[model samples]
Target: MGRLFWKFFFFIWLAQLTTIAAVSTTFWLEHRAQEERLAQLGRNPPPSPELRPDGRPFPPGRFLRPGGPPRPGFPFVPVVPLVATLLASLIFAALLAWYFSKPIRNLRSAFEAVVNGDLAVRLGPVMGKRSDELADLGRNFDRMASHLSTLIDGQRRLLHDVSHELRSPLARLQAAIGLARQQPEKLESSLGRIERESERMDKLVGELLTLSRLEAGVMGAMDETISMDELVSDVVADARFEAEYIGRTVQYSGRGEALVKGNAELLHRALENVVRNALRHTPEGGMVALEVHLDASGNDVRFAVLDQGPGVPEKELNAIFEPFMRGESSQYNDGHGLGLAIARRVVEAHGGRIRAANRAGGGLCVEIVLPATCG
Candidate 1:
């Protein structure tokens, strides 16, 4: 009933009508030629009819018009059959047009709904079981809509979480200010509390900005060929200083020189985050192991961190990489829970993957794999 339907209908109908008209013309012309030949033969009668061997009269010509039974009609077209064919073609053309345009109409309507902010609108159910290009198109539209819905939902949730996380520190800062006003003797301690809260807020904001840039795919270019061995050694050295401060230790091992191409700063932060996270979870006096090596295939560099800590639940393994997702344990309740998330984003931006698995001997193992470069 739309313009597309009408266009399809008109073109299809015109094609059928033209074909019928051409065939009808050809039959009419052939009939006229036959009549002319018959009339010519009638003008010069075939000498007298030829006689048969048994003395019975025989038609001199196969089509002996003058002697044969009379011809039926003049214009020579079977009007009934021709009219029936035209009607049938019209019906078939209309049906075919409707069949093709119906799915398209559904697609248009679904797109309009999406434009109107209805991201949940879909076309798969409306498309039926058609096994054609249009059906494939409908499936693609459904996938796109689903992706957009997920992204928008994630953005809303991230905003809410950000607001919630900021509120806590802001409230703490206000309380610290109030306490300082009430107790001049404790002003120094109160100011230290405010300073600590301010620093935490600053760190949180910085991580958030980094995550946003990574999600937007605008974190500078990955054009440097970084030495993984050196990077791991540097991170381990820094982690050890902190680990020893808390009666914990970080042990590092390297197989060989593994090279990768990426932004060194981001990669360094990612490695440091993973290492520090393990350190934080491991019980004091327990050692966190950080190892770097090339995989068996030799095409990828792997960084594995193992800690003697309570492993994450099976269901929460993947969720731990989401921003502000912390473990239920009191130890995990300290930080803002953005380190692993930021690490994940940086690793993924550099064409790498990160995963966590429960260690066999009652611990958690975090691994990052990056494509190795020859440089």
Candidate 2:
């Protein structure tokens, strides 16, 4: 019933009417010409009426008209057939117009709903079993809407988590200031507490900014070819000092240079995060093992970190890489839980894959794979 429908109807009806008129006119003109020919023959008497040896004009009418009886004053008039065709064309044109415009109307309605902030509106079910370009368009729209809904939901969740994470340090900073005001004698301790809380806040904010940049895919001029084995060795060396300080141990095993093309800083940070995360979960006196090797295909470098800790649940293995997701174990609840998330994002940004699984021998193993530069 919209303008489009009317346009289609008008054009289709006009075309059908034009065709009907042309066909009708052709048939009518031909019939009129035939009638004229017959009348002319009657006037001329067919060049001397046939005479069969004293025939006397051959019974008056038989000589004038041969074959069957006359057509009885042109019974095949175009008026009746033209009228029937008009009616049929009107019906068919309306139907064809509706068929083309109905899906368009539905699409318009769906667009309006989306503009009104309704992301859940779907056109697939309404389209039934139709398999056409319009139906494909509807499916694409559904996918886009679904992706937008998920992104918006994730942004909202990230905002909430950031606020929650910052609140604790902020509250502690305020409390430390108040304590310093109340007890001038313990000003030094209060100031130290404030400094610690401020550092924690700064670290959290820096991690958040890095996570945002990674999520936005903001890689700037990363044209460096980094050796994976060297990076892992550097991370393991740094982790060894920390592990020794905490009465734990860091063991490293690697082979081959395993060259990859990316930003060295980001790749190093990702590897560090994964290693430190394992070290944090690992118990004192336990060993965190880091291993680097080429995968079976020899097209990518794989870094595996195995830790002796309470493994994540089967369901949470995938979720652990999500921002601010922490394990349920008491030992796993210390940090803000962005380490693995940031690591995952960084690896993914560089066209890599990262995953974690529970070790059969009672621990967790995290693996990071990056595309290797071909020789």
Candidate 3:
């Protein structure tokens, strides 16, 4: 038998044994008292009852003739009834034990399966229809398992992508080095190519480190009050300078002072990444707009970045926030694909949400919503 069976057997058996022992002790003590009383009365205690003429012992007592009080002695205890009651109690305890142990056994088995690397293992259906705490435990286990499975899978994919992205730049750098060795006259040009690739790799690695820290919930410090208006203005001014190089313009429009409590450096980086991403996608002569506003209830600060470029597919809007995920339009863009992902993690660390959607006429709109501070 399993652990449940042994546990139930021992506990139930002990309880039944206690009950039988108490009953037996009570009966035995009464019998001993009666024996003591008889001994005290001596050998010829009392005369035998008188017999009737018909030889029926005067029928003991009759309705018409009242009989004397019953003799002071131990009452008879029925061994058969006692044995029957004990037997019935044992059976009931065994059934009760099984009822409780069955669910616990199933949970243990499910936990074992999870330990054995079966992330898909669930206990809901196995538990059937039950409205107890054990059932809730089972459901929670399934949810935890599901979440772990997702995280593991995502990590695997990220590793694969990182390796793939690194290979292309490394290969180009190697080829450039080979050319420089073959042609000494073109060494300067080859060195330029090598430097660019090295810088690209450096940027990729830096972004990856930032993403990892954000994912690990390291948001620096939150001891400062950030001005949302100034933050957006700084990001837009910097992006606009960069956008001008590609014939694109960055515009900023909003009203009122929106303040929040968070790390100023992190908030600035998060908003800057978003604004720069919009500027990168907007085509030459196109416009990228940044808007900061408070919701109607004034409880939330909202920042929206709208880009006049080919928006992503509807189904992929949410997926773009995942690490190293890029849309079709972004395939030709020169980016490490971790900007939005890092932005998302930073926002989440500050108890905020970021989402992307296609604008009405065209282009894409990315929105960030944060809880506003009272002061």
Highest TM-score scorer: 1
Better of 1 and 2 by TM-score: 1
- Count clashing residue pairs per candidate: 0, 0, 0
Candidate 1 lDDT over 191-216, as tens digits, reads: 99999999999999998998888888
Backbone clashes in model 2, listed as residue pairs = none
Overall lDDT per candidate, in order of appearance: 0.89, 0.85, 0.85
Pairing residues by index, what is the TM-score of model 3? 0.86
lDDT of 3 at 17: 81
| Angstrom error at residue 208, model 3 | 0.8
Measured with C-alpha atoms, the lDDT of residue 159 in candidate 2 is 91
Residue-by-residue lDDT tens digits, candidate 2, 54-170: 565455432225542333332366577778888999899999998888888988898899899998999899888989898898898889889989998888888998999999999
Best of the two (1, 3) by TM-score: 1
